[model samples]
Target: MNKEEANQTQAGKEQKAPKEMDANDLPKVTAFQDEATREYMVSTKEVEPGYYLLESKSKKIRMLFPEEGKYSDLLSNFSKNEEIIGFDEYDKEANILMNGQITYYQGQSFLRKTDTMIEIISGKNKYSEEYQKENKDNTEISIGYKKSNFDNLDRKNNYSYRYFGFVKPNQSLDEGVEYSFIFTCKDDNQSCSLDEKIARDKVKKMISSIQFSCNKEE
Candidate 1:
């Protein structure tokens, strides 16, 4: 082909650069920025409306929750030593609560500590045998349940169903933080049990998606 024809063909094949996204167009849970440098520390890809694939550089954590609107951030001051987060629901006077705690204690395991606490509070062998699962990414999870009878006059305030979960992440320097998740509900009615099961399933889904890495901010 002649040089003029070749040039015209090449120009025709060239595409325009995509437009930059406006902050207003982004999803609410899509990304979190660092206050210091105004840089993005956490980002997420929208899998579908209201669902995202979230990744965090600061926390070294990644998880996707479809029911993200239901959760509330309990801890604002994030720390390496300890942090807590939770979500709760009240329907038909049934209260269902789920919370997770992460603790960094070098080589210590939080599983034994939680087990001891459960035994002390509920008596020995009060909790059911652990249901354990090992994920392919080197995360280990153990689940168990215990019933608690609190001396409270208000039935709404009485906590009955106690579910505990221990997560052990893959080991390394500054490895995984010890994680514990507690799910609870009032044993007041059949609606409570149904909500408890639904919340429990959501917890499982959230835990299964968790991944810890050595991601660090520059």
Candidate 2:
């Protein structure tokens, strides 16, 4: 081929190289690093007394939180990974919660436990009876997942999310224990330019690398 023609062909190939790349070949999303923080690479955190590590081995994340409720013996926990037990809690005064429980219907993994006795007349139950009634008949589903949704139950100024589900059945997590991951704004005003949606995406992206384990911790 002529030199000029060969050069043109090589340029064409270079242009098509990027377009020819498969979407599946792209790297997995890691949004956690978009903003810098000392807390990245969670696997390196030092454990303090009375706290345990909830590490995502695949993701290399390790979070340390109190093993039991502060100064309380009413330990509500989930039997995770045979030997690893974890629990969820909420500080009513602070309007903050960590990994709370949610129940689901059959084939479904999350359901708001029915309060058949609590009459909604006084407005304690925001869910209309018809809404409750519709779901009440839903058979308790087996293993499944529900997309995590950001929530501010206490109407705290901070933004956060809760998720719950059973990766497996038979061993039901306790009523109060939450099966979710959560993130709270460190500052009330959230001084950053990133909007709430972007923040949530970052959190989800960070979790994408994590894989839940059911076996005992070594």
Candidate 3:
């Protein structure tokens, strides 16, 4: 090949090469709507000696978390990783959820948990594209907890936690943009998997405490 032709080929390859994703473009902890709003919120007094009440600044919502303990520290850090047991809220448009009804929103397939139940599911092959496609049209399936009922597809109980809940609607469901709550272990943590009772208790308390302003007016 000629020198000029070689130079042109190199330039074409460079142009076609995909750019690496910038760190800033990546989803940070603040990308979570609830965690971001907590920055501007007023810290409420402890609900009890060991638990403190957490409130959202804009949303009429409140929950309790451990005041001082290992769990407290873990929950405080909003960074996404495998070890931490934390909850996150984001706009439904950001379809990063898994395991449930596969529906299309804005022409993109989203795996949404229609049931308001907490369950421990196998992380094995959960991210496989084939698994997703298999359950794409399965709406009757739900992510609900059953005692000693582990649905490990590969017979490996490498479990992850998930509790998906939708915000309470004011009047009509179509009145406003809806947000979903994802209380998860983020990945397969053995400790998180075994601590189901404690996690379920705490999450139940938090969800029960949630009170909407619109509901109060009605």
Q: Evaluated with lDDT, which candidate comes out highest?
A: 1
- Please give the RMSD to the true structure for each candidate, in Å: 8.9, 16.2, 19.3
Report the Cα lDDT for candidate 1. 0.46
**Comparison by TM-score, 2 against 3, better one:** 3
Give the alpha carbon lDDT tens digit for every residue of 102-169 in model 1.
33333334334544433433343365565555564666655555555678656664655555555555
Residues 68-137, model 2: lDDT tens digits: 3221113332233222222344444444444422211222222223232122221332323232111111
Among all windows of 10 consecutive residues in model 1, the one with the lowest summed lDDT is 32-41
Tell me the lDDT of model 3 at 213.
Answer: 38
For model 3, state the Cα shift of residue 176 in Å: 9.1
Q: List the residue pairs that clash in candidate 1.
A: none
Candidate 3: tens digits of C-alpha lDDT, residues 73-188? 32433221111223333223322222221111111112233221111132321321111111111112222232232466553444444433322323322211112222333333
Clashes of each: 0, 15, 0
User: What lDDT score belongs to each candidate, Candidate 1 first?
Assistant: 0.46, 0.30, 0.32
Q: If ranked by lDDT, best first, what sequence of candidates would result?
A: 1, 3, 2
In terms of lDDT, the poorest run of 10 residues in model 3 is: 129-138
